[model samples]
Each structure stands twice: as C-alpha cells, then as structure tokens.
Target: MAPTKKKAEKKGKIQEFCRKYLTVDFVKSLIFSPDKLSFLTYFILFAELALNILIVVKVKYTEIDWIAYMQECEGFLNGTLDYSQLKGDTGPLVYPSFFLYIYSLLYFVTSRGSNVKLAQYIFIAIYLLQLWLVLRLYSKTRKIPPYVIILSVFTSYRVHSIYSLRLFNDPVAILFFYIALNLFMDRKWTVGSIMFSLAVGIKMNILLFAPAILMLYITSLGYINTIIQLSICAAVQLIIGAPFLMTYPVEYIKGSFDLGRIFEHKWTVNYRFLDREMFENRMFHLGLLVLHIILIIIVAKPCYLFFKNYARLRTLQAQFEPQIAAENREIEDLVRKKMRKATKKADEEEITPEQKKFMDSFEKGMKNQFGDKQQMPQTKEEEDPQKIEIHFDQCVQLALLPIFLINFIGVVCSRSLHYQFYIWYFHSLPYLSWFTEYHTSFKILILFSIEFCWNQYPSTNFSSILLHACHLILLFGIIRKIYKEIGLARQVIKKEN
Candidate 1:
C-alpha cells in the first residue's frame, strides 16, 4: 500500500474526497505527485472531457462572443477596415492580427463567416497545442510521465476548458507564451524570442517576462548576444507588423500600453485591496507603486542569490570530485535500495511498474529528508567557484517573474477586476508548479478553498469585498514566496558555479 493509503481509507475514490473538508493538501499532493500519472487516465482525461462537454453544451450550444468577434472579423476580412480607423473609446486595439488571422481562416472555410462554435473549436486546437508543448517541457525538465501530464492538464481548474472556451486574448497569448518558454528552455533562442515577441504582439501583458528574460539573456550570452537575439526578434516582428506600423503605429502602442483608460467602472469581481475609486485619488496610485517596488526589489534579491548558487553548483559538478561525489552517489544509491525494499513490501499484492517507480522515488525522497547534510557539501571547496550566469534560457522561465510583478502592481493599482480576469490567476499556476519546492498540496488547498468561496457564495457586497481582500493577500503571499525561491535558487546556483 502507498503511504497515502491511510488518507484514502473509507473513501470510495479520490474525487469523492472533494466533499471531505476540501482536503486541499491531499488534492495538491495528487496533482503534483510522481505517481499521479501512473493511473492518470481514468481521472484527468475523463474529468476534463466531461467538464468540457458540459461547458460546451451550456455555453457553446448557444452563441457566445460570436457577435463581437464577427464584427471584429468582418471588419478585418473585407479589407474595408483600415484597423487605423477602428478605435474603441475605452482602449486601443491591442489584440494582434494573429487572432484575426485565425478568424479569417475559419470564415473562409464555411463562408458562414465567424461562428462562435467554430471559434471555440479553433481556440481548443490552440489549447491542445499548448498542452502538448507544456507537457513536453515538463517531461524534459522534470522527467514526469505522460499520464501525469494529463492529470496536470485537467486537474488545474484554473487552466482547463473554461479559459479556452472564452474568446479572450489570454488563451492565445498563453499558448504562444508557453511555446516560447519551451523553445527557450530547449535553447532555440531565435525561435523562442520570436515566439515571445509574437505573444507580446498578440497581448501586451505577456511583456511581464521582459526583465527576467533580459537578465537571462545578458547573463548567458553576454551583452552582445542578448542584443543579437533582440534584433532577430525585432526583425521577425517588423516583418509581420510593418504594414500595420506604417498605418497605425501610435494606435498600436497606445492600445498595447493604455489598459487603464478602458475601465470606467468602479469595481468588477476582483474588488479587494483597492478599487477604481482609490486610483482616482492619485495618492493611492503613489502608495501602491511604492509598495510594489519594494516587494519586487525584495523578491529580486533572493532570485539573484539563487542564480549564483545554481551556477556554483554546476561548476562544482563539472570538477568530478571523486571522493565527495562518489560518497554522495553511494548515499543516493543506498536510499534507492532501501526505497525499493520498502516498495516491494508495500506493493506485494499488486503494482504497476510506474507506480512502483513513483513509490520508490517517494520513499527515497522521504529518507533523504532525514539524511545527514554534512555528507553532501560541508566545505566551501566542495562548492563551485564560478559566478552563476543567468542566460536567456533561464530568462524564458524567469519571464514568469515579470508576470507576477506586473499583476501584483495591477492588483494594487487597478480599480477593479472581473471574474473573467481570474485567468490571470491561472498564469501563476505554471510558475508555482515549475519554480517552487514548497509543499504543493498545501498551496493547492489554500487557493482552491479561496476559489471555492469566490465561486460558490452568493454575492453580497460585504462578502465580495472581504473575499477580494483575502484573495489579494493570498496572491501577495504566493508572489512573495515565489520571488524568494527564485532568489534562493539564484544563490545556490551562484555558490555552485
């Protein structure tokens, strides 16, 4: 039996536990667990498929953003639309022509023009591609099994079908962004940079990764290489964007940057911490800016340290210190041997190889928890001497930092947010999964509980505001912790290097 057997006792199945105190800890563990994919299919795929069917039936069966998208698409297709002439009083036309390009293709297929279901299908295809890329990246880096990928894909309520079904810029931009990240991780800089540029072009919010990416580029490739990559990315953008640049450069930039001008409403769904009324006060904006800057700076310091530490560690590893390295290897081998023994005893009745591997890994991890630290690296000599170098590769992942920073700033400065904007919350999930070593189950539960409260309770002004405040606090905590981890990792890398 797995260690989780005790937790599973008296339960019909894992999903049934949803009724049992939200078991946030357990849920998160399952989601992030190594054995998660051992039997992933019966859970993740079915659940997501079922949920998507329900969503499609409920919303897709009827017309959705079809009317609005059609208006946008028709204007683009007729060539009568200058895009320059098209302006919204609320904001600039920030959405890239890529989406419109997609719509144009769909419009051509049936000649029925822009159909909502068709659009939904198109977005779903894009999402599937994103899912594939995300899984591939996860597998390459973490060695997680494919079934685990399925579980991760579906179990994350925030990232599932709902976002794809919506006709928002988030879905497409996220797809491009993840692909960009994956390409960057693979060290295909030109492709990754172009993808990132396209993501930013599609939706400017993707620019949040700018600082981290730049830092990574500077560290890894040096200033000259970073410039070359940037130039390549810029050239790609110019190729696609030149025509529009010629006609409406100001409109494009304005639409991309001036998001605040659109929201006249005082509050939407995310009304916690502050609101539009507060921003109108001017003093509020100043105060918020100061707070955000302080937090970002605090977070950045740790990330820098983490980079240094990682670099140092890598440098040390390259030295092949036989005595120390061999001892460390022996300890790891012993742990694995013990874990296998334990797994054999526990899984005597029946077991899958994948499950057994996971159990073994889990047990080894547990044993290592109590292992002697002194045996690993007690002296400065054991550490890598080189300074950690941050590269564009790291920047691709680091790009997530800007997302958190910008969003934190936005949460503090913006007047209000809508339920729809919860998509932004989903953006943090990958960061949490890939970046941190914190207790997964615990974090998942906290956020899930908040999400439940936000979703389930009937809206009362007081409850709404209270929930918003709590959510903001949670967001703040998550961001702070993430930055801290990044900093710590940087330090570790630096030491190792």
Candidate 2:
C-alpha cells in the first residue's frame, strides 16, 4: 500500500507538470514577453541563416531544379529566348520573362553564370526579406500573438529547404504575394494589383488567390474601381509576357500555361496512389474536375452571404447617413465637453507637482483608451459616412475563406504537388489560424499535419490527404463562425431599429 501510494503520488506530480508546462498559455507567456519574443525572433533568424549557409557549403549539389535554373540562366545570358533550346533535365522553363530577366541579372553578377554560391546568397537575402514582409503584414493591424510567430518560424522548415536546397522561384513569388497583401490591407488597390500580377508572372499558382482579391475589390471599392484594378492586373501581365510572346510564341505558351504538359505520377508529392498511366487517363482528369466543381459549389453559398451582407451594410449606411452624422456630432461634442471639464479642473486645482503628474498620467491613459477627442471630424464627409459599422475583421475572415477553400481543392485535385507547391497555402495558415481562433490542440494538430506532409521526401498519400482535409475543415469552421457572427450582427441591427 505504501509503495502504491508513492507511485500514485509520482504519477500525479508528472501529470501536473505536463499540464503546466505543455499549455499554450504558458508557452505564450514565456516566449511572448516583448523582450523575450524579440530575442527569440532574432535567434531563429540567425540560426536559419547559419543552417542555410552550412547546407550550401556542405551539400554543394542537389538533384533538383537549381541545376536547371542555372542552365536556363546561362541560356538567357547567351541571348536564347526559346525555353525549348534551353530545356534541361527539369524540363523547359515555364516562368515568365520577368523571372528569366531577374535570373539573367543574377547570372551576370555571378561572374557570367559561374558561381552558384553567390546566387544562393542572393536567394538567402530574398528569403530573409520574405520573412520580414510576413512579420510586417501580421503585425500591421494588431499585435501578433506569440504562438502565431512561433508557428510561422517553426512550421516553415520545408520552405527554408526549398529556398536553400532546391533554390526554387516559389519564394520570390511568395515575397511578392506578401507585399501585395500588405499593400491591399493598407488600401493601395492599384499598386497592390500590380504586385499581385507580378507574382502571377512568376508562377501561375498564385492565381489561387484571385477569387478573394476580386471579391475584396468589388465589395470595398465598387464595380468601377474593381474593373480598373483588373485592367491594371491584365496590363501588367501583358507587359511581363510580351517579350516571350513576341520571340518564341509557341514554346513560351506551351511552357508557361499548358496544364496537360507531361508530369510523371512518381514525381508527385501528393496523389501518390495514382500511377503514371492512371494520371494520364482522361477519366482521372475528369474526376479531378468534378471534385473542384463540388468544392466550388460548397463555397458558393457563404461567398454569396458575404457579399450580400456587404451590400446590405452599404444600403444601411446610405439610408441612415443623416442619423449617423448626427450621432457622430453628438459623440464629438460629448468628448470635447469632458476634455474641457478635465482641463478646467486640473487648472483650478492647487496641488503639489507629484499630484499634478499623477493626474496628468491618469488623463493620458484615458485619452489613449478613448482616442484623442480633438481628432474627431467636424464635417459630414470628413466623418466618413461610407465606413460600415460591421465587424471588419470578421468580413476579412469571410473574404479569405473561399480563397483558402479553392487552394484546398487545388491541393486535393493536384496530379503533381511538388515541394514548391506548398508555398501556395502554407504561409496563409498562420493568418487563417489567427482568424479562426480554434482550440489550441486543433491548431497544433493542423500545423503538425501540414509540416509533416510538406517535409516528406516522397510525400505519403495518407499524410497529404490528411493535410488537405485538415485545411478544408479549418476553412469550413472559419466560414461557419463568420456566418454566425454576421447573423448576430443582423439581429443586433434589427433590435436597434
């Protein structure tokens, strides 16, 4: 009995330790204190740089796309515009002329296409810049929770490998994607559209975000503005592709946009169950088409609801413009009166300097919490009547939902998802996780699933399927949550009326 009691006590202590140490809250507190978080971020960046350098020095050779990229760069330097002529073991270069031009510049810098190391150093710099862009985008609107940053760093091992080991162009495209997203968030529509077009020029896979981008522009900026943005996007694409089209039209078109171009099933990281013959079968392609259609149908209703609510909000704002203006004026007047009263009291008080300082600090805290009363607009137009009182964050989550669902479907239907394709959806996971606010266990499980599948050399079919299914589930959950929030907002509006 004594021995049993001692064993039970030991087990209890072990459980307690696990409960305390293995919690999200505990980890968040430990790593996210401003000083500790900054140190950890810099440390991770340094370690990643060191690891990339060591791999570049020690591994020295890769049986992947980098060799082909270098060969193509050489062709560019030799004034060869035809990818067919420059085709190597990795097949023809399908990326746009802008991509080749960038490589051509790198080639010239690397002693006329001789030094791979210098080119890799350039890639490392781009990777670091991409990380900074991601951090900036996340930290722009609100403070990024510690776990998001941690996951962004740790769950991206595959991305790092792709940049350093494989030296793929996916990272460059992703960097542009991040820049576009950041600019779009700040409401720079035209420039953001141009950046997005440049990303698509690098890789057509970036088109996965097209639906969301279109929806956002339409709802936020109206049909005319959206049309203008689309025109800009098309113009940019044309300008980027003009050189290749004029020079080697057939080869460029086949290499850049041909989905039916040969892809071996064995080369696929996902869809591993299908063999070469099955992959090439027309029936298999049709089945994939059906799956994509079904995914789109599932997302259609929520997308409709999202836009419908936006329209309703616009109508409400327009109808209630006068009321909203009057209410704003009332609020401004109330704030100003409070501020004046506080100032008058402070001036009348004959207090010690220490007391005055304390009062001033308290007043400053109040101003910070409530915002500066002086900044309130005095004019009707200046008060921004067009601004919807709806939950903007929830709207953003809804807008991103269909985009993620489309990418999820793409992953599921992909005949050949190489390591580079992971860039299409991996970086968006942190943002999705932030918006969903799922249980910590579920979040961790999804992150692990994605990281595990992406890290696989020949990705196991089961893990790949699991990763796609998990992302779809997350997207569904987020859409459902947004739907509920919108419903609740409607109810509140009705009640107020």
Candidate achieving the largest TM-score: 2
Worst 10 residues of 1 by lDDT: 387-396
Q: Give the best candidate by lDDT.
A: 2
lDDT (Cα, 0-100) at 165 in candidate 1 = 59
The 0-to-1 C-alpha lDDT of every candidate, in the order given, reads 0.56, 0.70
TM-score of 1: 0.63
Off by over 4 Å in 1: 1-32, 35-50, 58-64, 80-84, 87-92, 109-114, 138-161, 272-276, 279-290, 307-415, 430-442, 453-497
Question: Which pairs clash in model 2?
Answer: none
Clash count, predicted structure 1: 39
**Candidate 1, residues 399-427: lDDT per residue as tens digits?**
44444454545454444455445554454
Query: lDDT by residue for model 2 over 251-341, one digit each (tens)?
Result: 8878777777557776677666666788688888888778767766766666656755654554565577677667778777776777687
- Candidate 1 Cα deviation (angstroms), residue 140: 4.9
**How big is the RMSD of model 1?**
13.8
